[model samples]
Target: MTQDPPRLSVTSQDVANHAGVSRSTVSSILNGKDARFPQETRDRVYAAATELGYRPSHAGRALAMGKSDIALLLMPNATFGPQLQEGIDSLAGVAATHGLTLMVRFADPDADETLRAILNLRPAVVVDLGVLDQAGRELVQAAGVRLVPQVINNESNEVDLLIGRMQVAEALSNGRRRLVYASLADWRLDPVGPIRLRGAEAEAASRGVDVTHIHVPLKAAGATEALAQVTAGSAERLAVCCYNDDVAIAILAAARQLRLAVPDEISVIGVDHTAIGQLVFPRLTSIAVDFAALMEALLRELDTNGYGPPARPDLRSSVRLVAGDTT
Candidate 1:
């Protein structure tokens, strides 16, 4: 196959010659300010521009218009993860319909680097996933860009809340259910984890059942040791509520190693309702976290209300208990 040289850049002049009109008339017609031109003339200009593949230089347009009409979406950490990808998919779909372009970039929570990336963009709108630090926030504000944060839990109480409370409520509701909550130890300090633990504890106290929490350190090497500790802890009720599906699966794997049966010997539950959660044996029973709604609301906040409008959307998304074979 032969490569084609970029067609010599076609300009309004070429379009004018092809359409048999003055350059100013072509500009007026193309820019949609051609009220002075008759309908037939307008059509001719458009047809000629289309046939000649003439495109006006966007540099002039951008210079005349102060706003670039571009949005920068900032995400925390890696982009390849399933959860992040799902959010990107949802945002991209909505942005396309609105004639907006979404430029996604990973922003580190570090003080200096984070601020530089955000300030450089000067984006019209910024959607933050709580990945920015204090300095980054200041940079975003200084740029005159609106910031929209997605509050998934008690964590980073910066935006609207979407943490799953019903999951803890249900687990705590079962009077006979023995409750075991598991999560990474670092999460204990996170707004979402501790708040969720509180809900579980509150519900357990009301039911007159004791709740024991086991923390697994974030270090991968320590996971096995932590899992051993989790499974070894003696609980009468045997119902385990993990912080998320990742931890829940880890517990399940540990349980199998200990020769324990799921739901029969130990009932396991988790939050997030991720794809892997449903694929596991006994189909892990879990709380369906509404990530789609969370992302949608975050996007809407950036587009319409910006920051001061509202924390969450008027529409409410609920978390449901999926009674899988496990529990």
Candidate 2:
């Protein structure tokens, strides 16, 4: 059997013909400038466009409106973990409801080159998750593209602090007094590790609990060395709040090699609540961030900054503790 040719994309002209309106009318109605037109005409245009699966070309819109309906998500130069993936997926869904196309790009260290290429697309907004540098900000501002979370201040650190607080709270609930913050050895992979450490320290301090800090690499040897440091110079039971599930798992394995009883001698809590955390020998207690709620807060922030449409003001705390065998 012969394969059939691909169906051509439906265009504005097709929608206009189907709706019994001129191309200009279809364009105006689809672009949300339908107030001058009759409600019936607007309904017809929308219904026809939907029926024909018509998608307006971003290039055409950019030419006409000076900016495409693209929301560029600038990701940090780090490992893409489950939390980041889930956040991206959630943002894409949220952005679509605002008639925006979501595009993700790993933020390159070469701010000039990265911004130069991003500005070429003429994105309506560039959303950064705590990665854009001073140079990148200047470039995006010069290009006149709206950047979300405009201030680029310490507000983003609140999320990391929340994670830290949740982890420490869960560890304390398990009756582990000696608290320790386990950060990743690679600084580039953990830009917010220090903020998280601070949060843990603050929380622990409030309860009159002192927390030691240790850096653990992903490798077995590094984890073993870190575990040694964690257990050194103390006989009291310890609780470790890890940067992520991977780091927590590494510690779990190191504990097994050291023959340390989890939650008895060393309670572990992690972030991201990854699936593998549940699959491990002793299920890893982790922090689960409500990415949908987080994205909604972000969208609302953008709206408040006059970058997008108004969103519901139902922002809630996104951090929660997932109970498991480890804690």
Candidate 3:
């Protein structure tokens, strides 16, 4: 049997002909340079392009504009939790409004190879979640591609710090003075754990509460062992601020095994406010990061750096305490 012929992609010239305008006019209007044109002409060009299902070719645009309309978000090698997923979704939504394509890539340990591949795409800017190494930064700079959240900014660490502060504040408000920071045992899985720990430490210091640091693995046995260290020789109530909900849940399980009463013997607060945290017994209290607000701030930063459009004016605090039985 004979297969159907492949359909050809619609082009700007086709849109121009359909709209009874020149190809240059179609290009200008579609590329957001239509201020000199009348509203009626701009409307005609947009309507024709939409009707014809025309999409600008990234390759062609790159040749004309020196870079493609792509915003690449470089994520560190870690578990993609609910909060991270929500931030990606929010970024994609905002990018669509600015006529930019959003792309995600897991950063490889070999920064050279990963960055080389990224440069091939000719992205307008490279945005990272604060995991880019010095080598990666040098390579991106050498290639002339913009890297967002410069070293001085430390915005990613600031967010982690906010999560840390929020977790400790919740525990403090519940009248738990003795504070413990439960960090993930694996550093590769949590590059930002140190920043969060610092935030917890800073908050605790301001309140005159000392925070002990402990590593808790995801497994039940490891978590139980860590909790034992916190409770040894001390009958005072403890508050544990976890790196994330998974870590918090693990501590909860350990507490159950040890027959410790939650929020009385020990209080737990987590970050991300994951769904599983709520499903467990004595539902977990967590710190919820408003990913939408974070995304808007990121977009605004990009716009200020001359890489994207202006972000919406509405912005609010990105972190809040979520009350639960655990805290």
TM-score of each: 0.67, 0.79, 0.79
The sequence of per-residue lDDT tens digits that candidate 2 reaches over residues 159-256 is 88777777788889857478888988874645778788988988888888998899889999889999897687878888999988989999998898
Off by over 4 Å in 1: 1-67, 78-84, 133-135, 150-164, 184-195, 198-202, 205-211, 217-224, 231-235, 302-318
Candidate 2 local lDDT, residue 160: 82
Say what the RMSD of model 1 is. 8.6
Per-candidate alpha-carbon RMSD to the true structure: 8.6, 6.6, 6.1
**Which order, best to worst by TM-score?**
3, 2, 1
- Residue ranges of candidate 2 with Cα displaced over 4 Å: 1-56, 302-316
Model 3, 1-327: lDDT tens per residue? 975452346777799899998876776677665777899999999999877878778777666767787778888887545877777777765554455667888877786767776778887777777657787787776776777655434544677877788888889896756899998887474667888999999999989889999999999999999999989888989899998899999999999988889988899998888899989989999888777667757766665655454444332367778899987
Instruction: Give the worst 10-residue stretch by lDDT in candidate 1.
Output: 155-164
TM-score of 3: 0.79
Give stretches of model 3 more than 4 Å off.
1-66, 154-156, 187-189, 305-316
Model 2, position 207, has a per-residue lDDT of 85
Arrange candidates, best lDDT first. Answer: 3, 2, 1
lDDT of 1 by residue, 221-265 (tens): 455566566556665446777777777777777677666777766
